[model samples]
Target chain A: MYKKSRARYFFLMPGVVWILAFTFFPLIFSLYLSFTNANMRNFTQATWNLVGFQNYASIGSDLRVGETVVTSLYLTVGSTLLTLTLGTFLAWLFNHDLPGLRIFRSILTMPLFAAPIALGFMGLILFNETSGSINSIIRGLGGTGVRWMTDSWSARTAVLLLDTWQWSPFVFVIILAAMQSIPEELYEAARLDTGSGWAVFRSITFPLIAPALGTVALLRLVETFKILDIPFSMLGGGPGSATQTYSYYVYITGLRNFNMGYASALAYILVIIAIIISTVYFWRVRARFE
Target chain B: MATLKKEAVMQPVRAVQIGRSPLARILLWVAVLMAVIWVLYPFVWAVITSFKTQREALEPTIVPFLQFQPSAENWSAELGLGARETTLALGNSIAISIGATVLATVLGTLTGYALARFRYGIGNRNIVSWVLSQRFLPPVATLIPFFLVLQRLQMIDTVPGLILVNTTFTLPFAILIMRDFFADFPDEIEEAALVDGANPLQIFLRVALPLATPAITAAAIICFAFAWNEYLFASVIAPKDAKPYTFLVASTSTVRGVHFGYLATRMLIAITLPVVLSLFVQRYIVRGLSLGAVKG
Candidate 1:
């Protein structure tokens, strides 16, 4: 029995080592590095100056840091709500006994599989200020074309729109599955009661799929907060940092600016936010399970 | 009073039973058409644009049609099939993605099986949460660390390095999905195999794994798509040699001059592998989503 247990531990050792070396170790090291002024130029023979809480304190005073956080939050929250609501509606629509429903579902899901960077470039072409497909459509409709990536609010909206266009199908697929799992007997019971469609959904469907919906929302929130490639490729966080997400900020700080310590500090802040959000989500899931 | 109430409800019931009114039928068809168009227009536009000539694509035409003369010049240029550098990058992407998918699936299956069958205290839950938390950590947060590690290991700018990183990103989700799948599986089959003098390994390989083929396929496809489509890490780690087709497509920006034709061609090529893979595994994909969502 002891030998067998030892063999089982050996079977587990590789995965455990990989996770510890790559995931957890980096996480802890990053947290430590965040306190020091460790730039890439000094990387070879690095001297750590421990500035207690200075990096955290600097986050508030630094305008760009504040803006990055605000932008990331805005994108995360806005995209999650829009995608969930629209995706749920579209899923419900697709779930209806309509002709060519499979084709519609497949087409809607195409963007989900397309690379984010590709989608960003496509968005650029589609939403260009001039000589673009979308602008041309608007012009044909006798309306002036809006500067999508130039204006601050418009740029943010563009990011949100691109994210929604790409990821809503993911939410749709998940939610559609949830909706489909709903027992037919429950619906029949509601129908026998002569209940309205809204009443039936409220009484039967919503309560059952709430956990699935919550999980999807949580996943989207986490993923959206970490988004980098699309915005980086699309507007380069653009017309003066209008769409610089926290992840983008980290990239620019660490890579472009070579401020590793500051970037690490910013990253730690993101980690905290991620942890809080994930903890709440898991807690809610557990609560639901219990 | 009861008779009056019954009659009041009967009128609406009678109206509904009549059904298939011309107005309702027309409205339904119209709604369905709009929904279909909304879903398909982007892809149709992409395909149409890919075939258009450079000048034709630039023209502000509201009614762009796919009837124009088609050319494969852009495809040849973007893919660089005749050139060594571009072809090598493409090959690297395909190899690394496949390698990572296989690695992640195998490791995830083992870990998932352990968690599903074992009765470890708090450890299983911890592992589950740890996997979930991996998804939450911003990919960028780990970029520097990964770069540093890869550099130290002399694995930078290599296929194996990229595979390792991609596996880390993909393994968590695979484990989560597979664990759920294995949990839902009947234990009696495995027990019977055990009773036949099969060890745990044999029970897994001979009994449990066969039953989990559909879920495993789904996991593989998802992992492959992720490894294939990942951009930031590929960009940072393998800027030159190991950059995938995604990076290739992004690199085709119209900064100096708009190469709409070439851009469209590259985008189409980049999306081809994933589209084909997804279509092949569409059934398994649906089963996976349904299993994960509904069961949870």
Candidate 2:
């Protein structure tokens, strides 16, 4: 029995060891670091005390921290919903083999290949108020420039749009795969029986693809929680901290402010929030997937 | 049975789609055109801007090459015969991506094979989910410890350091995709090999691995792309020589002065590799991205 198990152990060893050293170790160590003064200032000293609960306590008192959570939630929820709606719509629209299916799908995936930071840069330049091409066209038509970066609503909109636009393709690809897998007979039968498009889609397509939809939503939600590059690069999470995402907050806390302990705590908070949301979301669909 | 039915039904559907009902096909094509426009417009502008002079980048042209003069100045400036930073960053990016890909694929394939073929105790199912959840841990959670740890080891600003971090993030997806791949592998073939006196490892290495080429290619490309496009950890960990193009792209745009043309040049350079690979393996990505969760 031991010999029989040996091969499996051998195969699993590297990944398990790597995960332990990198993921689990960092996770536990970060928890420890969150309780102590582990910033750059204290690094050379080679010593620091346990300032227990101080980091966690500070998270509540910092108004920006609270606002940043709200900002993250808003983006996470907003982007997930928008990406889902638009992506599902696009997926269904492109479900049929039309002209240039190959070309359109390929082009749609182009942004997904580009770095998020590059996309952020693209967002930065394209959404620029004055020199922006969007405004350039508007101005050419003799209209005033819209404050895309300066105004809060428009700033958030720009961030949301970028987030949604870049990610909607992900949703489309997933849902389209799901939709493709649904047997055509079911669709054909539904079509023959039901005259309305809504009836066929609702009864046959939507129900069949619900689990895939759930998976897409869950994945998108978790990913959107960690959104940093686009909003940070596009707006620096500002126009008065309007778009300061949760991960960006933790980034500033650790990297910028040198608040290692607090940032570690903030990271835990982010993880905990993600865990809860994903767990709740997964509970509903877990059985269905299996 | 199903394929035959599908082909039969699709025959008429195709006829209706293109020949009989021109309006619906045109409408579908129009919707597709709008989406394609949305995806490509920014990239198109970036390309046009890359060719424009610094002056032309600021100026809006209704028609590229007509309203403004097109020059290779930006591309030349950043990507010319002797450009060092861009070249170095590209080299570092390639090293890190390839390094991470090799590590992730080799280790992940084994682990994925084991998970797919064997069953542990009660925790059998939780393992995949547990590993996948690793990605959800905000990079900041690991960044601080990674920073401190690497600083102690004096491995900071090194390509190896960047590769290790990239490997960590890419491994889960690698494992999951490979697990999905191996799960989808023909059990009958492996069983037949087992009956022919091949041990599991031999069967895996000799039989399963050969059959998993599509998945392996997909896994390799996905891993490579993830590492190639990684920015946050790359920027924080690699301060100087080892920083990848993604980090340079961000820093050059935000911290340093904007040579808008140079920026566009970097953008085009940065996207070329992943874009090319993705286009080449476009089918694999959809499967890889969904972990083959979607049936098709």
Against the true structure, what is each candidate's TM-score? Answer: 0.89, 0.92
Compared to the true structure, candidate 1 yields what TM-score?
0.89
Interface RMSD of each: 5.0, 3.2
For model 2, the superposed segments whose C-alpha errors exceed 4 Å read A1-5, A42-47, A140-143, A280-290, B1-21, B254-256
Estimate how well candidate 2 is docked, as a DockQ score: 0.52
Q: What TM-score is obtained for chain B in each of the predicted models?
A: 0.83, 0.89
Residue B129's lDDT in candidate 2:
59
Candidate with top lDDT is: 2
Residue A271 displacement in candidate 1 (angstroms): 0.5
lDDT score, residue B281, model 2? 62
| Model 1 docking grade | acceptable
Which digits, one per residue and each the tens of the lDDT, describe model 2 over residues B146-207?
98888888888999999899999999878877887676555777788878988778888898
lDDT of 1 by residue, A152-253 (tens): 888888888889888887788777767766767877787798647567667877897687788888888888998787787778888799889889999988
lDDT of 2 by residue, A1-290 (tens): 32245677777778989999998998888889889876776544223569999988888888788788778888889999999999998888877866556667777777777788887777777877877798887888999888888887788778888888888998888888778777777867866786776787789889988988988887888888889988876677888888888899889888877778888988998778767865665454333222
- Worst 10-residue lDDT window for candidate 1 chain B reads B10-19
Docking class of 2: medium
